[model samples]
Target: MKKLLSLFLMGLLVFVLAACTANENAGNETEQPDGEDTETAEKVLYLNNGQEPTSFDPPIGFDSVSWQALNNLMEGLTRLGKNHEPEAAIAENWDLSDDGKTYTFHIRENAKWSNGDDVTAGDFVFAWKRLLNPETGSPAAFLGYFIEGGEAFNNGEGSADDVAVKAVDEKTFEVTLISPQEYFLSVISNPAFFPVNEKVAAENPEWFAEAETFVGNGPFNLAEWEHDSHFIMEKNDQYWDAENVKLDKVHWAMVDDTNTEYQMFQAGDLDTSDVPADLSEQLFGEGKVEVVDQAGDYFYRFNVTKEPFQNENIRKAFAMAVDQQQIVDFVTKGQEKPAYGFVSYGFTDPSGNDFRETAGDLVKTDAEEAKKLLAQGMEEEGYDTLPEVTLTYSTSDAHKKIAETLQQMFKDNLGVEVQLANMEWNVFAEEQSALKFQLSRSSFLADYADPINFLENFQTGHSMNRTGWSNAEYDQLIQNAKNEADEAARYDMMYEAEKILMDEMPIIPIHFYNQVFMQNESVSGIVRHPVGYMELKWADKN
Candidate 1:
């Protein structure tokens, strides 16, 4: 009986071991509800886009927020890379003429628009002509001025046929430049140069305003646009390199308030958001902040064509009254450098010296001089006291703080009563563009790593020159610099132009911008170019 019990126990032990092994194997083979064997789920990247994009039509969209969304939705001949260098996009390769004034691009056969239409060379020709057409009213039409005959066409001296872009074949596109611009390739990567589908645009001028009608040719397609709340973009299966794209979707929330956006980020509702200035110190201490030296300037422009501001003394007085050091140190929390000039510090001259350092301290605060100038300006305008002027800024905590500080400085040092006004980004941009305000906040991010980009805005009739301030000498200097072959001569001409700009004071230099933002550790492969562009084509949430 004892021997029989021992055999039974041994059999039971073997059976128990077999059952446990079978259960372990079954658990390892478990599948998702959809029967997919993948261990991870589809990834979606979330971000606070800062503001509602004014427009998605590439030619009409000029602000950073608009360009950010457009960059994901469209593909130009080239695209900005990690170092802000030009990388081939729709154009597979190109051949430069021996004279360096012409480029012949070979379009990729696999490139297709979101609607499954092949992106032909004719599309580029049509787009270039459309951008230069005065009737289009694209603020960025000046971007095409580098192409041969572009300026003449834009100025109504020539017809669209006179423009030097041509399509030799369905796959071959060519462009002739009026001059050899070293940064031409880099400039074309901007959204203004992206191709537009002639059929779609002609059929409906408002196509880009709606997600369903917007046909893009980039890594993502606009799936939904909820005006002030958020927008959703999904992977574009038709993109040429779609196979390599990592994230399945991207959600851009339009959150203007930095504090609220940061709160959402902390709650894992956002993958990235700009850090509020007040919280930068704490975030940096916690090793959660990323700072990048930006090639941009934050400044305010005077309506040079309008009352009071028409007098250069008033503009100069306002420029000198505000203490830039205080704004940078206290308001910005030392995240930015005090800008005494329009051009930021990241750019370098041909000799490798910093541009800002080269053009040192063109403007600075002087309470006494500012007071005297204010009195003189009012006296010239035939008023014992200065009239109440309104200062306008976009809706943001940082901007509000800066505007309030400037208001206080003007009242204290110059005895000027300045009213503060705040508007949403879209409205504020329109107000500035229409010259609807006395003084307004503005900023310029480098389109390319050249001082010319900063100075080009003030050219006569330039759309961005909202100040209506024109100087023939300034225009001529820029032209001379463009034509100059000697590096030293070009830089010398630029410096001279900058001096004239500073002395005239069409815009008040506030501070040079530094990119201050936060990103979660789970996000990877995001690219922030020094030129103030963010690219997320390769970003993954794993």
Candidate 2:
């Protein structure tokens, strides 16, 4: 199989920022209650992070900081644009062979890493191949499924030599694809495709986590990281595209308490933080806070390998009882959109066709119908009574409320008693990976603006596919889509695959996530990605 190239024109870099500034009125700053005097501010942005990042390495890391830091420091052949589409970064121009199986990239000669090392095509060749290497255990290997022999290589079913990644010259890279992939260039923008210095990573296994050893080609470098206290990233002067990079420094602090984070923002101790469910109205009154509504999804995945869940009727009954709109309104305080599909609503194809609508309709809410389905499933399984199952969620107050709502919905509608388990976020992740829980929360922010990025993760044996789901028909549908040449035909196949999943009821769609934040009026330049997380480069303190 040869690697395929789909041409995507690069968009000009646009640094969008919020212009609002947090200036203290004299009446508020002093007891005298004077009318006008206030002081100017410096460019410093403080953010409140809910989870402390576990690692900084792209392969082993899985958290906000890990991805955010990489996005700021390391430049990939392609990058995520403001529109969340793939745009050229290090590769100024590229070409696809007439066969549509070979991609030849021409690296920009002026590109350099933070260490002043020349950015070359060889770096990408190493990076892509290294990710497919079994020993690397990159959680990101799922993103490489489109490359020639990539899936087989990751599964240990093929030799690493079979994977088609080659460097034609210092500036030119030739990658062969097994099939033409519509999202191939968009995949390149993902961190899984970001280049790493082979010489450095090989010599120092602990390079990325250490400040001094960290080598990056992006706009900023890891200046300092203190586990629970704070981490800092300073601007990298040697970055290839440094001219457009702004902000001298970024201070990232981990604040687990939503109230504390809100207070920090209110007191001007922090420039930006997510608004807690309690304080949204108070902060919204000031006209400084804004919401980025089209991002992420909050849903629970049921591990189908579990006996009762293995029965499709049981899963369908469970999904049909819950009203996602109510969940969004009551639990998320109406800050989010109800999710009708697995992939987010804002996601689209290259031609700008919305996948959320194209993917078949999700399970409808019908309590009376749910009861009949539950009874039928139990009878078919020859069970005298309903089986007991547990739905697990995080210990956060918001999560608890949602879980309780779901539990009540199931009980009242289906007449089944469900055990609700709440644990800390870390514990929940560990248990989910271990398959310790029958049902668990599994939300995703699309790594790229493609349905393939979300859909492919659920194929059998993938790490993120913790539900122990396996289906020959589902797998074949994905393969057929990948091999299908016509764009419309391929998408139709994808839509069919999603429809099959919905019919099978393997997972429940809860709500499309909305990133809600309450920042002080004084803060400025804060921008949000539909993928979640704030991009600080464009941020400034007014």
Candidate 3:
């Protein structure tokens, strides 16, 4: 398998090299000596995606609609830049109290929703209070765990209004934290933190949850959304930052099949989509395609509280047993790199080669050794034969194929019979969040470019920590790292916490995801940020 992967990767490298040369030649072919504009037609853009969004409400399902809808309909305290750092959005400037527990934000005075209402700090206050409301059942409420008294509030043990957020005035907001957090700004940029119009939402309680009910302060508004179909967003002329907004409109279509999207791009129906697996090489240097290694990771989570996987030895054995290279080559078609550690490569470290290299050693792959470990774990559990484990995944053929491949790998290596269960994407998400699955594959899009965003998920009480894995020692280390003012000391603490997770083996690192988009050469101003969101505000159809 290793040899095959090496050969395939080598071939892919050659193909990519040829593509790069071709692209360079094309650039030279189209070069205008100097001070020349190769401008073309303008303003409208067509976007293609796979899987229709399950909901437009940020507090509900996690889907493309939930993300794309917010781009035009709401504004958060901050927005992530291409580098994954927080930049000004509704809040223009912010300051942290010396103790790092209090944050004050100065709102952009001119910001307004599509309804023409001036955006006030009160709106953010109301939105956050509503998010922590136990009645609201906001799935991402765990994001508020950093806020003072948030956990208590979310648990229905305290009042929502008392959850550490206050509006000092229309243009100013203050947030008190339970403890100091290094990635507080990044967390604030998340969709769950986006501010909504309290009055409008109350008048039309169901509106905020529906496609047409949204009125945002974003660069675009939800013009139209067809369930299980496509969604359309039109430029918000009322956007406070409209002068910088470029695209007149954007059409987003959910398309799951890579070949289907490829065909759409070929027919000029889609401006861009992920490159198809079979045609990666042909499209590599073709003036119209763009591919980059994205800063994200895809991993499999084994529910630590569930049967079979509840055993630590089984978890560790599974983590060390799977061959990540094979999956990268066969499943993603050489689009992604094998992830050796939790943090993906390309993310710079404050001081070190990278977080992965700085903090740890990669898990060694040894099938025989893994089998021995599994047997020992089973014996320790007083079971002669391992219980039949069910690994769940989404309904897509690719996801199912990946799940089956993993099942077969375990069976072949460890003499364990594994079953595969597939569910629709949305259903799978609900099941995972509810701790209703034994094992599932998940992909994490970095909310920020820090190791904290990814590592925090495994912490106890984290909303996204569906596996039910937590260690008091690990949690303490994270909290200590946050409280530490010394940068080096903080990083060391973080590394120590990461080592705990690595040893726990609750998560099996697969590959760091890579983003691939196919577009026409004429499509300009499309920037791919590390967080995987396209800031269509500056996108130009020309």
**Highest TM-score scorer:** 1
**Model 2 alpha-carbon miss at residue 86, Å:** 2.6
Kindly give the stretch of ten consecutive residues in candidate 2 with the minimal lDDT sum.
6-15
Model 3 Cα RMSD, 1 decimal? 9.8
Against the reference, the lDDT scores of all candidates come to 0.85, 0.72, 0.75
Write candidate 2's Cα lDDT for 263-344 as tens digits.
8765555666766766655666756567775456688898888868878888889999999988776556646877777777
Best by lDDT: 1
- Stretches off by above 4 angstroms in model 1 are 1-39
- The per-prediction CA RMSD against the true structure, in angstroms, equals 9.9, 10.2, 9.8
Off by over 4 Å in 2: 1-42, 62-65, 281-288, 293-295, 347-353, 358-360, 520-527
| Local accuracy of candidate 1 as per-residue lDDT tens digits, 1-542 | 97455435533443353344343123333334553312144466878788888799888887798988888899899988876789899999999999889999999999999999999999899889989999988888988998988999999999999899999999899999988888888999988889998778889989899786899999998877778878878788899989878987677889888889989887667888787778877887888888887788899999987878998888899999989999887888747889899878876788999878998999989989987887888889897666679999999888999999999999898877899999988888888889899899989888777888898888989988999899999999988988777888899899999999999999998988788888878799888876767777878877
lDDT of 3 at 420: 86
Score residue 318 of candidate 2 by CA lDDT. 94
The candidates, ranked best first by lDDT, are 1, 3, 2
lDDT of 1 at 499: 94
Total backbone clashes of candidate 2, pairs 3 or more residues apart or in separate chains: 10
Model 1 — TM-score against the truth?
0.92
